[model samples]
Target chain A: MSWITDEMRGIVGKVMREAVSHPIALSDIRKWAMAVYWPEPLPRQYWDEDYAAQFGGIVAPEDFNPFAWMAAKPTPDDPPVSMSAFRESELGVETPDYKAILLTEIRARHGAPMRPGDVIRCVWKISDYMEREGRMGLMLYTTLS
Target chain B: MGDPRTLAVGDEIPAFSREGTVHHWNRFAAVNYEFAGHHWDDDVARHEGFPAPFAMAPLLHAYLHAMLRQWAGPSARIAAVGIRLRSPFLKGCSMTAGGRITAVRTKAGETVAELELWMDDDTGARLSTGTATVAFPS
Candidate 1:
């Protein structure tokens, strides 16, 4: 039986949205910077009053955009398959048939710089699905926003 | 950061390498709120078929970004970035992140450069591949 069934194909175009309950905090940016070893002088730009003043105030790293949404705690009303849930599923053992799901690719475009106190929002969609033969076996690729 | 005008398509960017540490991973997990067993709990990771706790994919992506941002300089604007994860970067593995300038051109009155980036373990095996575009002052 093909894993890429019509039922699975039907998931294409499905969308989920989420909003950060609070503004992006300076502490959150600092923590992420330190975690990734984002150089010293640059980390200062995220918190230091002097360094950040150059950027019009503390500037969040460009890549930190996605993490802003990740740091947001989910609300009871949020969709079950929201961005947070999708990430948790990728790192958790929730795949169908107990098969492993690997992240093959990721693409992101930077829009606005999220400074301290900026509220964040995220919208993700199931863009496409395909099946292909792989070294391990049949592989199902799902593209999400 | 090097002068963007002087950079050519074949030049190799300065390499950035780091030794993965459990302490660093722990700090990363705490910050990301990622308590996945495979990232911290060795027993669970082994049960899941990994030789040891593996680094999170985002962390590896962050490493590649750091490499790019450092090379691109503070004033340069990163327009886009993409990565393909080839294999898991296990905890405590030493990896180097580097890239080569693939193309350079002027866009919208600004100089832009495209780069092919990659991460390789100490054994020289590629763990991930990536591409990035950055715009600099012409």
Candidate 2:
């Protein structure tokens, strides 16, 4: 059976934009760097106040915006659900019982450098969807921006 | 750091390797609010078809970025990045990130370098592959 129902495909162009609650912070950058095992003798730009002053105060790594804008998990009062999933339910399609939603691909583009205290706004859309066979069974491929 | 102008198409960027650790995974989960069991609980991961808790996709993507930015130095700017996750990177596996300069050109009067980046395990199996574009000062 095809997992890509017309209901799911109907919302392909839907877009959502929101302002993140908190500004990006220096500590967030540091934690991410540490988690990735960023090479030792950590860059002075991330920690040393004197060295960071050269770049208009402490500068985050160039790719740090994603972390800054990550959405917080929804609380019980606010269940997290995607627009496509909602539409699927409306069309009588049951949510799959899969244990994980794997990320098959990602594409990102950089804009302004995000620094400590900079408020971030994220905008994304459902670009496309398709169904294909997988090791388990049918797999759904969805693209977002 | 070598001058961007001196880099050739075949030049090899510096390689970076790190062993995945549970401590690192926990830190990433806390920082990113990624409470997914498959990334932290081995039992849940095994039930989900993974042998062990695996690294999150963004973590692996950031590792690639770290490799590129470290090789290019502090002044470099990454304009774009694209990645395809071919296989799971299990916990405690040693992963090495490296890339080769695929092309260099002047665009909009700025020198740009394109690289094909990848991560491989100690067994030489490719876990992920991607491409990145970085701009250098002229």
Candidate 1, residue B54: Cα displacement in angstroms equals: 1.3
User: How high is each candidate's TM-score?
Assistant: 0.86, 0.87
Give a tens-digit lDDT track for model 1, residues B16-114.
887766776876677666666787788987776778887777777777777877788666778888889887777778888889989999988788989
- Which consecutive 10 residues in model 1 chain A have the weakest lDDT in total? A84-93
DockQ of each: 0.56, 0.56
Error of 1 at B29 (Å): 1.4
How well does candidate 2 score on lDDT at residue B87? 83
Give me the candidate number with maximum TM-score: 2
Off by over 4 Å in 1: A38-42, A65-95, A133-136
Query: Tens-digit lDDT track for model 2 on A32-139?
Result: 666655446566677777877766677667556443324342222233443112233423445455556888887877777777887666655667877788776778
Model 2 ranges off by over 4 Å? A38-41, A65-94
Pairs of colliding residues, candidate 2 = none
